[model samples]
Target: MTNNLPLTVKRSIELLGLIGLIAVMVIARDIIMPILMAFFISIVLLPIYRFLRNRKVPETLSIVLPILLVAVFVALIVWFFSHQIGILVKDFPQIKENVKQHIDSLSDWISRITNFDDKQQKAFIQDKSDDIMNMATSLAGGAALTLSGVFVFIGLLPIYIYLMLFYKDILLRFVFMWFKADDHPKVKEAIYETESIIKSYLIGLLIQITYMTILLGGILLLIGIKHALLIGVIFAILNLIPYVGALIGNLIGVLLTLTSSQELWPVVTVLGVIALVQFLDNNILMPRIVGSKVKINALFAILGVFIGGSIAGVSGMFLALPIVAVLKIIFDRTTMFKQWGILFGDERPAKSPMSFAKFRRKRNVEVKPGSEKG
Candidate 1:
């Protein structure tokens, strides 16, 4: 009946459905983000759970152990970062002094360019100070809301992971119920491929974080930059969010450099070094590590990140690539959505400089030798 509909009508219906789905996603973003995160994490941890199960571990224990390990690992990262933050806080006085000195230098530079005296500048700032305070007050509220969301996301994550792992069989059954037994082979293959793609993508990301941190931090430290390790780690993790993350990472690294040093050269050096690392990661390391498992092209990847961010903020951005990747795998397997799969995929047109005549001659010559032998 749906197929009998006119193409224009079918497309209109699809467009409506897409709009409705996006609306639902935006409205329930808070509820959705944590579950989505846990789903991906569960995929990443599935192997560990399976390993334990194969060892004849109790079902509950197998589920709980992986969650516990993940919890502990996260706690360690949080603790390490908290220590770094503490050191940062302790240097607030020095940072404040540096800021004042920098401000004075900037003011002097401005005075040289413009006719405004220091007194006028001070008066202008006084006029705007009230607006700044109001802005800060609103920002404080936003910060509190963000904090609450983070707490909710963190608190529910482990619970969701546990439930997902415990009821994975039920979930698999639910998926299988969508098709008849005759389609089971194709369904199972899709599931396996989706699982493979997600696992490889997540693991490759982990490897990326480790090496990016080491290389970026080590290079900055060698160049005598302050907070080199922290900046490196920040960029490494942020770079996980695909195209948008790297740009944000650059902004953050630059901000850190500017705040830490009064010199301009360090900031330039930091940007240069990050660009080099990004070049290496994009061209060499990423392809080797991730392989062809998740071949999402640049356009869709960027659009997905933006769309995901618009729907659910940072969590959405982080989840976007894997979600699209999983969708691509499923779409490629199914008959109806193969066009979407092709759109998401990164298949390039093969090109050869060899002329048709030259190619035919080579093939014919090679075939003639084989024919003679026969």
Candidate 2:
């Protein structure tokens, strides 16, 4: 035992080194996360670049066209929504009045059931209303700031995207050149898989958002909602956030409906429309598109969202799934990281039916068909 003490000490030192490396990675995550996000976004848009190139479009023009298209679309949306926002802001007092009235009505109903008098109910509400209003004000302020930040980011994004698109081949060569010539095939495979996953996810998300927006907007309009387009677009964008998005959108719709109209049917209709959209999203849209390519399970999907939210807020959450998918592709291609790939993969182990003859056949072991001897 005494003679083996040196080997034990060395093993302990190795274990400590591994833990230290992991700690460093965790600490440096914030610095690395943004670059990772940018890379993944570039990957997602690569197919558009390729499509243009295939059509004999110049590389520079191909890259610029998509970015310009996105910028123009965003500008149009902002221009359209600017009026609605102005109205909402200018009519703040009326909105507040409507909100307060709704709250009072709700409080009355609750107090009746709980046997609290009107005075006590008012007191309870008064204490909480200030906090709620403060929160709402803060959220609105933050959203304004966030919108401005988005425009800034969008302005800068094109530069990065253009560089990535224009120099994509050069970048690929550089990446593969980092390894030996013999390793180029594996590197190419990894790149292809990564690009495929990103493209599939982005396309699927775009299709899903568009369909949900149209469906929800049409339903809300039929139900006589005031701001059907505005609400539908809001829900469609928020739906990108995964599980919490639809619920948040519904809450907003319900509140807006309750305040804008006295009719209970419109509120019910809005709720029903959202429920139908969510059902379609989960059962039909996701399974057909996102589920096939980005095959992450629910537990890891939730974890990814949380991790992403912690690291970069909403942007991180939006990016978490694609980043994980890219990592899964890379890991699956590398022998050193295959176990990580397995952990992330949705594939189940193949199960074989119990049969000695069948097993022998599978193994290519020939045996007499009627032989009973062991």
Candidate 3:
């Protein structure tokens, strides 16, 4: 139907379809996020599960073992963080005092700037308290909902993962059946590439998290920072999200330092350390480990992250690049969407990003009144 339509009409239909796709994604995010997360996790665990299977382990045991391992690992992290939280709670009085001091300092600065006495300032604040309280209430409500959603998501994840693994063969067959016999080779290649990319990316992430946790945490510990391990682990996990994650990790480190210490130098040191570590990770570690296996350029990776975040919140952002890479791999193998795969790829030495533009301009140049004959 779209093929018979005018160009503009066809484009309009495509645009509407794109909008509808996004709408469905956002509307169904809650239902989709857990399953998608499970899918990725299952992919990462596939090798280990396969290893156990090759050892003649029972199917149920093979699947259950890796899930148990992941659960234990997550439990350890939670336990460690909970212990740190307990320490923070113990220091609540000190933290409260520090916060109040900061607030009072701000109030005094405001008074000097606006020429309002404390009395008038108090009245102004009192007037806005209703609005502020309403906002606080709304935020608290949102927090409760988010917390509940997280628990539900966590609960469903393992179940989804188990089911995905158990039905893996059926799913593969289903995918194969979607294409013709002649296209099976291409489909197999796509599946192989997808699996390779996912495995490499995930393994690299695990290495990154370990390297960062030790590097960052150890440096902070040497510098006598409290909760160094906690800070390091948090930053390491957050740093998984690429450029934006590092910024957030830095903010978190700064906030933790500021809240923990009265001195200014620790904050500076924390920021400096995070910056230096990020520079090393981006320039040296990541390139060596993850490499260009995904072959996505920086531009589209960042764009995908933002778009994914907008569509499905944090889970979307986390999964965006790998998903795009998988899509690119599949698209590149197919005849119809090769152009899209190219757009998602990084500029290589063989193909300059500006080549097409220069070619177009050169081709459009006229003979210039027979000057070219000379």
- Cα-lDDT of candidate 3: 0.83
User: Which residue runs of candidate 1 sit more than 4 Å off their true CA positions?
Assistant: 124-129, 348-374
1-374 per-residue lDDT for model 2 (tens digits) = 32355756855765687578546646775545545555666776676777998999987888888878767876887886797667557767766777777777888798778988888887877889899999998899889987886666655666777777777779878898788888788888888777777877877887877888789988888868867777787888788876666677888888777766655787888888888888887877767776475466557777877777776677777887887788777767765456556556555333333544453221223424432111
How are the candidates ranked when ordered by lDDT, highest leading?
A: 1, 3, 2
Better of 1 and 3 by TM-score: 1
Worst 10 residues of 1 by lDDT: 365-374
Query: How do the predictions measure up, each by TM-score?
Result: 0.88, 0.77, 0.85
Backbone clash total for model 1 is 0
Please give the lDDT score for candidate 1. 0.84
All candidates' lDDT scores?
A: 0.84, 0.72, 0.83
Better of 2 and 3 by lDDT: 3
Each prediction's total of clashing residue pairs, residues at least 3 apart in sequence or on different chains, is 0, 0, 0
Candidate 3 wrongly placed segments (more than 4 Å): 1-17, 103-132, 348-374
Alpha carbon lDDT at 361, candidate 1 = 22
Kindly provide the TM-score of model 3 when superposed on the true structure, using C-alpha atoms.
Answer: 0.85
Spell out the clash pairs found in candidate 2.
Answer: none
Question: Best by TM-score, which number?
Answer: 1
* Predicted structure with the largest lDDT when compared to the true one: 1
